[model samples]
Target: MDEDTTLLALSAIAHRSRLAIFRLLVAVGPRGLPAKEISAQLGIVPSSLSFHLKDMSRANLVSRSREGTFIYYSAALDAIHGAIDFLTENCLAGAAGNPSSR
Candidate 1:
């Protein structure tokens, strides 16, 4: 992932509610959860959850699909993984004397 994408994903989950939502979705895996289920599980009101979901979707951190009348939201695993890899690329490479060796 590029810097912009990484920043976007990071910013999206920076809020407490958004972070919680993302974690919940990630825990549920690709099967996802319907909006009502997510709100109930997180104790978030429908309007608040809707707002957060919109921000997450805009950041490409989450995606949604319609199943009948329900909208299921899932974490964008690939985007999340890409951001993590980008942020940690070559992590600890320049550490003094290699902590692992100690």
Candidate 2:
């Protein structure tokens, strides 16, 4: 990911609720969960979850799809990995035995 995209993804996850949402999604895996289930599981108000989900979608941190009448959301894995890669791209570049590398 480019600097701007990475920044957007990082900023999107910076919020407490958003981070919780992202972590929950990651734990749930790519099959994802319905909007109602997410809100219930996280104890987030439906309206608030909707807003956070929208922001995350804009940042490419999450994706959604409609099936029947429900909207299922999942982490944008490619973007997640990209953002992580951007952060640690050069960590311990030549420190072969660095503990931090592990």
Candidate 3:
């Protein structure tokens, strides 16, 4: 991921609610969860949840699908992996004398 994309993804989860939502979505796996359930679990209002979901969507952190009248949200693993790769690009653990290497 580029710096701009990385920044957006990082900012999307930089809030209390957003972080919780992301974690919940990941926990539930790609099957995802509906908006109402997410709100109930996180104790966030519908309006706020909607806002956070939109932000995550824009950042490619979460994906939404309409199943019947409810919208299901799932964590976007590709984006998450990209963010992790970008953040750890400079950390070469296998390099000789690397402190991070076991």
Per-model TM-score versus the true fold: 0.87, 0.85, 0.87
Residue range with the least summed lDDT across 10 consecutive positions in model 1: 88-97
RMSD of each: 3.0, 3.0, 2.8
TM-score of 3: 0.87
Residue pairs with colliding backbones in model 2 are: none
Candidates ranked by lDDT: 3, 1, 2
TM-score ranking, best first: 3, 1, 2
| Candidate 2 lDDT, 1-102, residue by residue in tens | 788998999899999999999999999998889989999999999999999999999999999988999989999989879988887774435557677767
Residue 48 of model 2, lDDT score: 99
Question: Candidate 2, after superposition: displacement of residue 87 in Å?
Answer: 1.4
Error of 2 at 20 (Å): 0.8
lDDT of each: 0.91, 0.90, 0.91
Superposed Cα deviation of residue 54, candidate 3 (Å): 0.5
Judge candidate 3 at residue 52 and give its lDDT. 93
Per-residue lDDT for 1-101 in model 3, tens only? 89889889988889999999999999999989999999999999999999999999999999989999988999998998888898787444455677567
